[model samples]
Target: MNRREVLAGAGTAAITSLAGCGGVSGLFARPTPEGVYVPDHVEGMEMVGTATLGDVRVGLTYSYPHRFWTVERDGDGYGTSRVDIADDDTVHLMAVPWDPETELVLPNTGLSVAIRTQGELVSQEVIYPMLSQRMGFHYGANFPLDGDGTYEVTVSVGGLSIPRYGGYEGRFDGAAEATIPFEFSADALSAIPYRQLDERRFQPGAVDPMSMDAVPTGVAPDPLPGSQLGRGTSGDAVFLGSVVTADRFGPDPYLAVSARTPYNGLVIPGAGLSASVEGSGPVRLDAAIDPELGFHYGRAVPGLTPASDVEVAVDVPPQVARHVGYETAFLEMPSFTLDAE
Candidate 1:
C-alpha cells in the first residue's frame, strides 16, 4: 500500500464540523460502540510531559520523521509527495489521552482544542498520527518551530455541550487548559529513522495509484464557457463542480461547486470551498452565487500561468446546511498545463 492507502487504512476520516452553524451535528451524531485502543509510548517518540486538566488528560509526544514528505496537491489530501522540511518546518504535536479508560478518539460534545506556541495559535485538528492504528485518537496539530530550542506549548480545550454518548444534554464543565515545555535538537531529529509501512501488510494490486486523468472533467456553459473540472462523487448524492482556470496571469482560477444530485440539481448555497496550488501559497477562491448556472462559484485571484505544470487541491466540507456534500478528503486535479493563448 502507498502512503494514501496507508493513511486511509489507519482509521476513519475525522469529521471537523460545528453544530447548528452547518447541518453537520446530525450526520455524525451516532458514535461507534467500538472504542479506539492506542499504545502509550513508542520507541522514537520522546515523552515531553503529561497533565490533567479536567476529565481529559493529555500526553504530549515529540518526534520527527527521518525524511519528510510533502502532501501531493493532486486531489488526494491523504496522499504525499517528496518535499523537505524547511528551516521553519511545522513541529508535529501529537495529543493522546493519558487515561486508559477514556476513549478520546471521537469527542461527541463538539470539544475543540488548540495549541499556542511560537507566538502563534495552532488549532488542534485531524492530523495523521505515527503508528496510525496504535494511536486511537485524531487530536494533533503541526506548529512552526524555528531551529533548535525550548518551546512552551499551551493546550486549551472547551465546548458548550457534553459528549452525546455520556448521556448528558446540559452544559459541560470539562473546560480546562494545560501548558507543557518541549525541547528540540538537530542531532536528535537526524537520528530518528524513517517511519515505513510494514512490508508484510503491503498487498500488491490492492489499489490503483492516483491519476489526474482519472477525475471526470467537463466544459462550462454559454457565453465565455471555459474548461470545467468536477468530481461527481461526494457525500450522499451531492455533486461538486469547478471551472479549470484558463492559463492567464490575470484573475485567479475559480471553482464553482454546488450540493446537488444528478437527478436534482438545485443549487445549495453557502458551502465553503478553498483551493491550493502545489509549491505556491494558498489560492483564495471566494464563493460567489451564480444564479444562472444554479451553483455557487469561487474565483481564484491573480490567476495561473500557462505552459507550467501545477497541481490543484480542492477541499469541500461534508455538510452544507441540510445538503450533505463531500467528506473531509480533497479532490485533486491532474497536473494541469494550459495551452498557449
Candidate 2:
C-alpha cells in the first residue's frame, strides 16, 4: 500500500479501537480528573460571531472551560504540559483566522483578545495557536467572564511574521482589530453540546474535525498548483512539494512545500524549514501564503530543474499548542528527500 493509505489505515484502526472497550489498557481506560488527555470526541461549539479584518476573517467560538495543554521550547526540540482550568474559568474562547478568499486557516497570526463591558476592559490575553480533534487549528485560551451580561469582544490580529507570496504579498502585515458584541449567559453556555467518551476518553486516536456552519475548519487544499514533485511524511506531518514559476515570485523557479496533518489535511504553520537542491547547499524556506499554494514554506531556487534532488529539513517544529492526538506528532521530524516527478 501507498504511504497515505498506510497512514489512513493506521488511523482508522486506532480510532476504531479507541471507540471500543476491549483494546484500551487499564492505564488509559479511565478519564483523567484534571489536566489534558485525548478524548473520544467533542461536539460542535456555538459561534460567538465573525468579522472581517483586512485580509483575514476571524471567527470566535466558545465551549465549557477545558483543561488543555501547551507547547514550550525544550532543549533542541519541544515539550508539552498541561494547563489546568482555573476555578474562575467561565469559557474556553477560540479564535479562527482564515483567508477570506480561500477560507484556509492562517497560522502564526499572534492573536490577542480583550473582553470589555460598558467600555471597561474586563479580561485580556494573548491566545495560543492550538490544534484539536474537533477544531483543527485555531487560537484559543480559557477565560473568565464578568458573569452574565452584554460584552464586547475585541480580537486583535498581529502582522504576519512569515514571508508572503503571490497575491498575499504585502498583505496581513499591519495589525487589525475587530470588536463584536455578544450576550453572555449561563443558559447559552450550558446549551453547548458536551459529551464524555465511554472507553475512548484517553485513547490513542483522534475524532473527526467538527463541521461548523460558516467557519473554516483549517483544512488545506489538495491537488496544489504547479508541477507535483511527490509526497513525503516527517514526524507524522505530510509534506507535498511542488515547483512553480510566477512573475510575482521573480524570474527563478520557486519551491513550495505544503505541510499538513495526516488524515484531516489541516495546515501546519509556524515551522522553520530549509530545502537543499542536488546537494547545492540549503536554502532557508520562509513560511508563506499564496493565491494558489495556500499556506506553505517556499523560496526561489536558481537553476532548479525537474531532475534536481531536493531535501527538506525541519529546523523548528510547529510552535503551536496541540490538543491530544497531535501532541505526539509534528515534533522530532526527520529530514526527508522529495521524489521528483
Candidate 3:
C-alpha cells in the first residue's frame, strides 16, 4: 500500500480504540465534579492537585482547550472529513524543593510523571529548570478527558541526590498520587477561539459552519480526511524558524517543515503550507497547520531513508484575516534533520 493508505489504516485503527474510550458521547455524558478548586493564587492555572513526595513538592495545573489530537473518519455516503477532537486539555505538573534560603528545582532527569485515565497511562515530557520557566521546572503533558470523572496522576522520582549546601543535602526516591476530577461540557469548549476552527476553513466575516449544535450526539462521525491539529506560540512580535522530522508514521516515515510568519509574528494552525524533501524518493507533501500544536506538520512521507540528504523546503503563504488579529505574513522554514531514534 502507498504511504497515505498506511496512515489512513493506522488512523482507522486508532479511531476504533478511541471509540471505546469515550470519543464524542463523553462530551455530554460526564458530570462536573463538586467543589472544583479554582485556585486564583497559582499563576492563573486551576490547581488540580499537589503533594509532598519526600522533601520535594509536586503540583499539577490544568486548563481547557489547550492541546488537541485528531482522527480521520471514513464517510458512509458523504465525503470523508477529518474529525477534530480536543483530547488534550492542557496539563502541567511541576516539581520543586523547599529550602531555608530559596526553592530549588530538580534536574529534568531526576523525576518523571505519568497520568492514568480510563485505564490508560501517558508519560509527561520532563523539562529541565533552566529550559522552562524559572522555579517552574515541570513534567507536563496534555490529556483528553475520556469521560467526566477522576483520573489518577502519579509523579515518580527516582533516587535524586543534591549536593550538600550549608550543612544539609537532599534526596527523593518515591512516588505521589492524586485523584483529579473533570467536568466535560460542550458549552465550555465552544468558548475557545480555536475550537471554532475544528472543521472549517478561515473566511472573512463568514459564520462558523460547525456550530456546537451541529456536533454529533451519538457516535462522532468519522474524522474528516487530511485533518490537522497542533499548538505553538510566537507571541505577537517574534518569528521562530523551526523544522521537524519523524522516523516513522505507521510503517512509513515523514519530514515536516514550518516557520513562523512575520505577520502577527506567530504560526497559525489550519493554514495550508507546501513542503518538499530533496533526496531519494524526493517526496513532496503538504503540511497543515495544527493549531493545537501551534505549528504546521506533515505526518506521513513515503520512502524516507536515514541517509537521505538533509534538505527540506517549506513555503508558507501569506495569511490575511481582517476580522481576526492577523495579516499577510511570510516564513522561511529552516532546514534540519532527525537521526533515527
True-structure Cα RMSD, model 1: 19.5
Estimate the lDDT of model 2: 0.77
- Expressed as tens digits, the lDDT of each residue in 228-289 for candidate 3 is 11222222212222233422234555444443322212223323343334454334444332
**TM-score ranking, best first:** 2, 1, 3
- Each candidate: what lDDT? 0.36, 0.77, 0.32
- After the best TM-score superposition of candidate 3, give how far the Cα of residue 148 lies from its true spot, in angstroms: 2.5
Clashes of each: 9, 0, 21
The model with the greater lDDT, 1 or 2, is 2
Cα deviation in Å at residue 276, candidate 3? 46
Best by lDDT: 2
- Global CA lDDT computed for model 1: 0.36
lDDT (C-alpha) at residue 59 in model 2:
95
Alpha-carbon RMSD, each predicted model: 19.5, 8.4, 19.1
Report the alpha-carbon TM-score of model 2 versus the true structure: 0.85
Candidate 1 segments whose C-alpha is farther than 4 A from its true place: 1-43, 65-87, 98-131, 160-174, 195-198, 204-341
